[model samples]
Target: MKELYDTISLQFTLKDFHQQKPNLAFATAEKQQLIALLTYMRDVHRYTHLVFVTAVDWLEENRFQITYMLHNYDIKADFGIRVMLDRDKPVMESIHHLWEQGRVYQRELHEMFGIDFPGSPGVNEPMILEGWQGPPVMRRDFDTAKYSLETYDHRPRDTREPESHMKEKLYPED
Candidate 1:
């Protein structure tokens, strides 16, 4: 891994080595160089499969972590690449050329997490949450209970129901 990585030699850290699958994580401080690394991984190291692309929302930090998982079938090894996006303006270049499956992953991320892949077609289209009208649900700050109550019609709950139920259950011995 080190010899192959040294060829392109963009500064990246070995994030984990002891796990069942070793992983090297790259921070997106140099986002442009990431594509180059992916190309080398695919063409040279033969990590030809793009397993997945996904996002994680960190509400406190106001950032999103985007991960790209690539698999090298010949060696049975999986590699991960990570990039952080500003939650307010979550956009990144798409890896559509390297792997066609990236379109679906990007599109789903856009719908669920509000991340955008400008270069990937259909990324903005509704995929999973076909008619979703609320803010991105996957974001940590999204209040799902609030959205559900407001979006869908349901019978109002009794305000005293919780108190009565708790009194009966906790004091059953009484």
Candidate 2:
């Protein structure tokens, strides 16, 4: 970890989440420096496996925090690369070069959080949820319960039955 810190010390800030272990994270000092930082980690540190990518909607800060978790089996260390994007503009370059699975992660985040991966292939395609319309529903700004109430009829919990076929067969209810 210190080796990486020493290399990009000027372009990135190395953060140790805690003192107990060397679990390290690097936050690019500038958005433009993110690709360079990620490339350094992949080529030099051998953190080849991109476990996952996700984003957090920082409503109060009006920004989205994107994190990429990478693992190096040889060194047995996890390296995280983080970038913050403006909530309104929420776009970043794709790290598909480092790991192919990144395409799917980018697509999901783009759908749910409305973050864009500018150069990624198939990133704009629909993923799990489909045929729906609106601003990213997972954004902190989107009120899910409110939207559900407004769009669909609500039923009281007490008035709803379990409706389980197994329960009927096992109990033989009257």
| Candidate 1, 88-139: lDDT as tens digits | 8888888888888889998898899988889898887899787888888888
Which stretches of candidate 2 lie above 4 Å from their native place? 10-20, 24-29, 157-174
Per candidate, the number of residue pairs that clash is 0, 0
TM-score of 1: 0.76
Predicted structure 1: lDDT: 0.75
- The model with the greatest lDDT is 2
Task: Mark the 10 consecutive residues where model 2 has the least summed lDDT.
Answer: 11-20
TM-score winner among the candidates? 2
Residue-by-residue lDDT tens digits, candidate 2, 1-174: 756566667556654432225865544345677777777778877887888888899999999988887778897877666778999898888888768888899999989998999889998888977876877988988999888999899876754346765577678965
